[model samples]
Target: MTAVVSNSTEYLLGQSLSSRDDDNHNIYTNLLYLDTSSPGFNDPITFPKDPKERENLLELPGNRKVLIAQPAVVTDVGDNIRHYTLDCHGFQYVNHTTKCSKEMFLDETMIKASYYPEVDQLIKDVTGASYVHLFDYAARGPLNGDDGDPKINRPVKSVHCDQSYEGAKRVVMSRLPDKAFAEEVVENRRFQIMNIWRPLEPIYKDPFAVTDARSIPDSDLVALPVIAGDYTEESWAAEPNSAHRWYFKFAQKPDEVLMFKCFDLVRKRMSPVEYFMLRLRTGLKSICPHDKALRSELVWFTVNSSSNQIHDRYL
Candidate 1:
């Protein structure tokens, strides 16, 4: 299939927001090309087997909306094209009591702390966002990471600190509907992304819905970079060769690539410049009323000691 950006500008703007076709949903879908040779490649791999399977597991109701999702080419992990299972969950230890594990919880803390003035200021003092935007700093993504391979099924553990991270913090915003009808809509798009990961139940014909889609803002979903790994084993260096189940790992092609897939609307929430810089270390200068270089209004940092990686993400 042609790369998403290869399509015409007109096609992009007119692209359907509702989940219907893979072409339309490709925007946010993980880019992992499946390796059919792997066992259970055609079947869904369930571990703890989430009852809901994953929340709002489908599209939401709304008027037609348009967002741009451009394809970006970056250097691969190495020489070989590492194949990865898209959307595998990665967990990390923060405090003795509060262990942050899932993607939903991680996204929530990022949105609360990263978007606030105080946290933004701290980021500014470290990274110069004007030039280099941090796309996904030390924040975690939706359960993405190499836990090993489905062929080996090795259990892993990990511990992390904030200093050894590279990605930037990003704030994601979505106006997708939250009604019963939204489930069907999302499922339609999910099919386009990956039939491997779907809700346990079929779409709810009369599910409850959220009326205010705009209530959730981009800053409400923030994340940072991290050096994550299992303590018992070498998380980054080990090969994923489990016996039967599928786990996160790169293809053996030498170029280790991370596989990811998401819906069209989900793609839009993550592809912006401002959202990219929230996680990097940038240098910030106190605003001078007369300075015209400030891209936004001068806002003071709000100190938030309540914030900690206890619930932060580093995927």
Candidate 2:
């Protein structure tokens, strides 16, 4: 497949907002793709089930971007086989509990002080990461616009990848100030870059959607270096392509959780840099859209807190 950069220009005049304007009543569709050459990318792997990988040796590092995905399934995503290799699929829907009030998630302090442990355990339970150190959390994605709704956290409608392999390590390092302890933990065990997304209220207007890692070609991903507040990191963005498939469930209730992987030790790791670009959904919105008194944004990184595994940093 030939990967082509959709436009010669990479800048945009206005920021695009995310909405259900492109929904079709069918709630499903198959997207087409015309491939071309992408600057830098390689070592594409299949997901959780098939650990096989296809490499493009022509692609180089320091300027590479790759995409990963998992196809849609109506069955419950919580019952996954842990013994299988997670190379083919990059995302999953797990049933989890936040144990925090809607208000607590909205407040950063309340989340760290009271709800951090629950998330810590969730990561441990699912990924088998004996010890997790959470360096940061965001009340990402605006959940609602109702009276008390904190709408500042609007969703980034543009498709872009933020967490890179190095960024994932930085996240771990940020949590563990003791460099020696961090090295010991990561070296001994595998860690994953995962995120937890849920709705605070019954969702209404704009809901979240993700591209299946399967939809993206390894060459199609463009990596770029990012300067976050305190650290410089690497991230991913997809150049526009039709072959890319995007999916979202109808009316994801508050009880369900969307768990997706970004980078993992088990997968091929590469260092690359490219600007962010992604295939945007172009179509119609759903016919039976619900009313949104408000939408609640519930999301955070998952990790475990095991003091014995490393040093006594928590102490």
Candidate 3:
């Protein structure tokens, strides 16, 4: 059952936010969810090292199909898009104009020299993070067809978050070369692992969608093991929930960026280790409507930030 809730400003499925008068700009599509009904669903592992095997495991018997109405970002409305935040919605869309050319993304040197600084500043401006460390960046597009670019990674269609709470902590500790500094940041300071995503071209098909973090309950998130070579890390895959609200911007431009939180460490009474283990996890949702083959190319930057003073600039 689908219900459309509307207001003078916004239109949503379960809740109304804001929308343009001319068009609601909501897209109805099917998003893949974890099939809890599958036999032996207790143990589910994804092999990132082997794409074919992972795809086979994630499809058909393992996937639950659900039709979703994703609300588009109403850019015409005043400050409507800015209302969504990492603390509230787990994702936010911002207008950021980049000086780097499209061709610059293809080269590693060019990307580091031209594009990295832009992303570094963008994260700082958005989050008000005192220290920002950009650890990784990757370009992703269609799997079968490549536009002669070797650096492009395949787009993921599953509904999953990039990191678990434990996984996020591990990333912070591992990425920092100095063990003492890592421990200090993880223990005393508040930190967040965020991803900045921007389309390399105008989005035509397979637009990226993110769930309202408020709509997701702890019960719906299932921690899954992601195996990469010899190492294993935990990530989250969400079970289908009727209450889940998804949103995306149609025909998203290259200048626009989607900033979302993977893990956020806030001040609390619990010990850092215990807190990370016991706290309910929150992550950015990766929802794509795979009606047509996705020809979109996107650049993703994973940035880690701390509330305290700056230590190392880039790691």
Q: For each candidate, what is the lDDT?
A: 0.18, 0.42, 0.56
By TM-score, the candidates rank as 3, 2, 1
- Candidate that would win on TM-score: 3
Better of 1 and 3 by lDDT: 3
Count backbone clashes in candidate 1.
64
lDDT of 2 by residue, 154-187 (tens): 3332345545555556666665778887776455
Model 2: residues with Cα > 4 Å off, grouped in runs: 1-88, 141-151, 185-188, 267-315
**Using Cα atoms with residue i matched to residue i, what is each candidate's TM-score against the true structure?**
0.18, 0.58, 0.71
lDDT over C-alpha atoms for residue 186 of model 3: 75
Q: How would you encode candidate 3's per-residue C-alpha lDDT over 189-297 as one tens digit per residue?
A: 6777767777877754445667676777877776766555445666776776767776766666776677666677676547645543223223435433222222222
Off by over 4 Å in 1: 1-33, 47-110, 113-177, 180-261, 265-315
* Candidate maximizing lDDT: 3
lDDT of 1 by residue, 19-108 (tens): 223432112111112233444332321222242332222222211112222221111122221221121111111111112222322243
Compared with the true structure, the alpha-carbon lDDT of candidate 3 equals 0.56
Name the runs in model 3 displaced over 4 angstroms.
1-22, 39-79, 147-149, 268-284, 287-315
